[model samples]
Target chain A: MPTAIEQELRPVAPSKLSLRHVSKIFRGQSGETLAIDDISLDVSEGEFVCLAGPSGCGKSTILNLIAGLEELTSGEALLDGAPITGPGRDRMVMFQEAALFPWLDALGNVLFGLKLKPNLNNAERREVARFYLRLVGLEKQENANIHELSGGMRQRVALARSLAPNPRILLMDEPFSALDTLTRETLYRDLQSIFSKRRKTIVFVTHNIREAVCLGDRIVLLSSHPGRVREIFTVNLPRPRDINDAAVATFAHQITETLTQYLETPATKEAVL
Target chain B: MKRNLLTLLTFAAVLAALEVAGRNGAWDTRVLPLPSEVAAYIADAFTDGARRDQLPAAVTANATAATLGTATSTTAASLWTAFAGSTLTEALLVTLKRLVSGYLIGFLAGIPLGLLTARFNFFRETFGLVALGMQGLPSVCWVPLALIWFRPTENAILFVVVMGTVWSLMLATEHGVRTVPPLYVRAARTMGSRGLHLWWRVLLPAALPAVIGGMKQSWAFAWRSLMAAEIYVTILTGCGLGWLLHNGREVLRMDQVMGVMLIIVIVGLTADRILFAPAENRIRARWGLDKN
Candidate 1:
């Protein structure tokens, strides 16, 4: 991963979106099950926050609530000041699967977002789409079909599509979990640079501790089985922070240890309590 | 291209063997015409225009029936009347009308029903199994009931066509909707698409290839049913290719029977090759669904 630092870059002022006592329950033939339990967190604008946990920890469930893909059974998820009722154009999501429309080429996928913005003419939509595609270092791959692109390239296209709409907040659900380690690291660096440049508010979800440490300005770790935020860690590490840096290593170790301890805790402990 | 050529070669070899067997008295030549004789008969039918004269009567009747049927059912005047210049034109127009109208009605009803059954749990539970069960019923079985329901009118034929084609389309659409990757829906929802917007933008496009495949299957069904309906039920108005085939059989003119049969096969093949093949190819290619 290549990292570059250039000072004098203006920082985007923070805006906060908060969740208050949010709970989600899913009903099935098996019975009603709690997916998330009284999860509450606040995310500031232009801050890269990662929700890290084990598989089935409802990390994704929380992100979905924020994006309004799922409604909270109890309590509230608020964006800015208003309670989220459903998905809005202001909050976009990127998934582990690129989910690029196969029929559309790379540029077409980006343009699909821009065209949905309302009242943008053909030429303007084209120009805006091109700008974002170029931003993602995919200028030459504009006409390439989804299948023609590599996994990393497809994710880049997905990122460009998500960003092209210029949403107030970006929600990513294990976005790089599908990519190889090397590709994921490279994407992490590129994504960090893009985030710095755009300063868009982002809430990323992942199970990987190293990934969360490398990318998040703040990491929110959730405990599994009726997911609840276990701890929130702030990483004040400066820009171009090295993965090999002792501080980053220590932070990763601390988060992983905490997560492991949470995972190992017995379900019977709750009954005993 | 290579496969098509090989297939043609194989077909020719089989026909040659049959011709040689008939000529050598290995089989009765009277019951089965030699390949050369059939080819010659086909050539004469086209060049001499003997079969062409009989074509007019069949085409004229089918067109008249289709026009009357369309007029009675809907206010929209039939396009068949406009194209009824020659026997060939009339036959082509009537068949085309039946195909378009049947497919259109099937698509309009099937897609929504498919989507509904696919999306809503209640609808899926209630109707999905029923729809799948109905698909197993052969379209030809509908002819007698359709005739009775519409009283052997042009409406009866249209109904048969619609019934024959609709199930495949419905099944295809349902399958398409069910197979749409959940990730796409999540992604679309994240981008603020919901309800009709979600269906139009995400669900419809994702389900399109399957729906199209269903349409092709529906067309084949409609075509087959139309022919069968014409053979059994006397529509009393329309002149269909099936009527021509029946007439040939009635007159005991094997040459005419063979000629009409050739026309039917040629037209069906042409439509499949020219219209549906290109559209399907383009879609498959775009979606990366094609293996070849």
Candidate 2:
């Protein structure tokens, strides 16, 4: 453990979140179920990686492990060479549900995490929160209550709240899944633009193969039932990659084929509904 | 416009019917006094000064006894002695003491217990059920027990009021805590809030509406229990609305009893309408928790 003085003195490093043979087993009243079996992957500094798998395939369990929101049962998760014992400011997770506090308006929700930060006065905190709100294209919606906003708008607020703290690694668990297709597409373009400008390490989880192909530099496919890394496919596509492009389609097909094969296996076939 | 007019018409019709019935002697006067008679009684009490002198003495004795009893019971002190002033002042002091002390005790114990029951399943299983069971028993039922434990003093009445209010509050808090959406907890955990901070920042705010609703119910129960206990219990400590009602009954003054009953209704309704309504509405609107 780094001493507080030493930690303060050390320059902030670009976070490289890594998992080594991580596994999670859930024991319910009925029986013991393995959620994730020995999965190892590395998300390099400023890289966009998507973990793509079918529903209930433990893709979210991987994100949870990386965020240190849940114990790994086995193996280790590290951020910038430091082993993650629990959740910290360095890795922020955004969920499918916006989860913005209903009591707080957009600005207040964004400012919630910023308030916990040290050395910043009230004025500075407000400025920082406003900056992020504007960054997410919600400057005018700052005072709007969470309920007043549409579903897509709520997700945007959640994104602003997560990004306000400027965490080294952004962990999103199917954040855009709840939005309509058109809204999801718009958010994807916006997110891509932000990622291009900010160059933050993002681990995005999604079941949408096209989304994985569009957003991620690399897509890691996980097999269902005791989820493990099935394949790691690198997309050599340009920025603002078109989902309708032949190349993107080919890649999606190849990845989907591999995922389908894994799903068809007798043990997993029954589990992937 | 039509709906408003219809509502006004309905109200007028009811009043007109009541006036007609009273004038025609369709109902027994003693059992259900005419609205005009009640109004006349009120006007006489406030203006004629016929009953004014007796009012002060009754109020003073009741106020002193109530203040001293509750204060002595809670603090193990003789704060009631401070009531040795003018009759009106003593009455005011006694009412203030009972209301504040009883409310504070109920709130302090109830809120924490509510939180505890909400947080821990074991606590909820044991204490939640216990609280629920106790809530079913009227606060007035505790008067005999309070008298036995605290003796024939004002402490007994205070004890009864606290018992009446606390369980409802605790149950409300527990319900609020339980009903907090899982998303909020997950979101708070992601933001590195756990244990105390999680409970304070996320759980508490989310559960506040239910808790406040419970508080309103608790106050209603406390008010009723305090009046009943004061009237029946052997603790001759103070003069409250209940004590006043009791005196009217003893002197066979049905008009005075009706007047005191009117006071209770007015005070209770005022507290709900003026204080609690706006607070609850604001919370409900903010959370988007209200159905209508």
Candidate 3:
């Protein structure tokens, strides 16, 4: 841990968000089930960090906790040393479902996000919305209804909506997992470029190993059965890294080996004891 | 277009069959008049000199006698002139006024209550369930209560109309608000929309299709209730189409009775086509719920 003064003086800080000993337990009629057990991680500013794990790993739960969409059972999630209270304009989320309001057109949906900015007048808000629509390659489909757009286009509109607010942190939970392989590949390309240009502090959650390796600066691997941080791998690969690249494959292979080790070893069965 | 043509063709065929039946006395002419004669009667009812010639003095005497002192004691010619001329139009206008006012009052009260009931558990368990129960009760069942409360006045008719409609509107609104996807609400909240703003932007738009559907149903209920109140209650208000339909039957003028029935059917169809259908189609189209 660095002192407050030291943290301020540092040219490039290590963390934009810090989670300390966070745990989540869900209570049901059957009894209590520990979803996450004392997980801690730091995500730096302008860094794309992926919380990658198998199903039931509480990866999505962690994203929700950081989003302030859910209350933590214990511990804290801090944004710039301040505890996240609730959903705010400072942190925008793109859900797995595009979740665009069907009643609004693409431009209207993006403009809705711009409503968070009190400074912009109607005209200025519209201009900002149009700019984001263009950025997401949806300039032509601004007036199109959600059902009229392709699944990929709907996600693009959702991306534009999330970006229009210019939130400091973007939380995405398996946003592209529903799209086809080709559509997901195209999105990966666009997302990388967008990340480069916008430099937003993004926390992406995914179960795909290659997706995590392709987009994240640092990947935090979580193991299931009371999800705990199994490992953290920093990808030293350059920007615009392809999912099919050999370097990504090497890193993915290494992460998979560790994950396999955890699955095979009975020593880690200390989980109950 | 082809479907509409088919509908028109079927209607024309029915009218032709009715004309044949009426000419050959297949059934008593008094039982169901010739469709052509009913159409002609309706047309003549609107024309001044033509209606005066067509309305017989014997029919007028019979109308006044059947209801006794309840029918105003004007001379046959004067009564026919008044009934066919200004009275018919005046009746339509008065009925329209009552329907619109009652429907509007129900709409104004029901929508907010529904939204509130859907959002709050207390409201849902109380007013929401009560409203659903009220909808199951027949619209005419409120007529007796309305008559006792307001007596023989315009307010009585208005009260019945409101009672007939408000519960359905409330239930529709509650259902609409309740069924709005949680995804949209969550998404809106994350975008910094809270409280009333959240309801206005996300919840209202998401619930609009169902709300409009409810409004259409309320209008139908209000219209039906207005007709029933006008016919049953001896109110000291202006006569409406229902009064005319009652009078037409009393005089044993089957053609006149059928003409009024045609008008009622036409008015209802016109309102549905002009007001509700286009609005529903527009909502469906904009929301991408329109498959076509």
Which consecutive 10 residues in model 1 chain B have the weakest lDDT in total?
B61-70
For residues B1-292, what per-residue lDDT tens digits would candidate 2 score against the true structure? 9999999999888867887897898977666666665554443333322223346544332222212333334331222232233333333356557766787799999999999998889999999999999999998999889978999777887898899989999999999999999988877777767888889888998888888899899888888887787678544566666766677677655655686677668778987998689989988788777645
DockQ of each: 0.54, 0.62, 0.64
Candidate 1's DockQ: 0.54
Candidate 1 backbone overlaps, count: 5
Q: State which candidate has the highest TM-score.
A: 3
Residue-pair clash count for candidate 3:
0
Residue A237 in model 2: lDDT = 93
Looking at candidate 2 chain A, the ten consecutive residues that score lowest on lDDT are A4-13
Q: Write the per-residue lDDT of candidate 1 for residues B1-292, one digit (tens) a residue.
A: 9999999999999988988888899866555667776565444333322223446444332222212332334322323232234344544566667766876787788778888888898988877777778778877788889867889887888888888877778778889989999988887776766788879888888888888888788878888887787777766576666776676567554544665677778888988898689888878777777555
TM-score per candidate, in order? Answer: 0.85, 0.87, 0.89
When only chain A is evaluated, what TM-score does every model earn? 0.91, 0.92, 0.90
Order of quality (DockQ): 3, 2, 1
Put down candidate 3 lDDT per residue, A1-273, tens digits, no spaces. 974333322233223898999999999998998999999998888889999987778998998888888889999999989998998877889999999998988999999978767776787778778878998898999899888998899999999999887788889999998899899999999999988887789999998888999999999999987899999999889979999999999999889888777766574444321
Model 3 lDDT on a 0 to 1 scale: 0.83
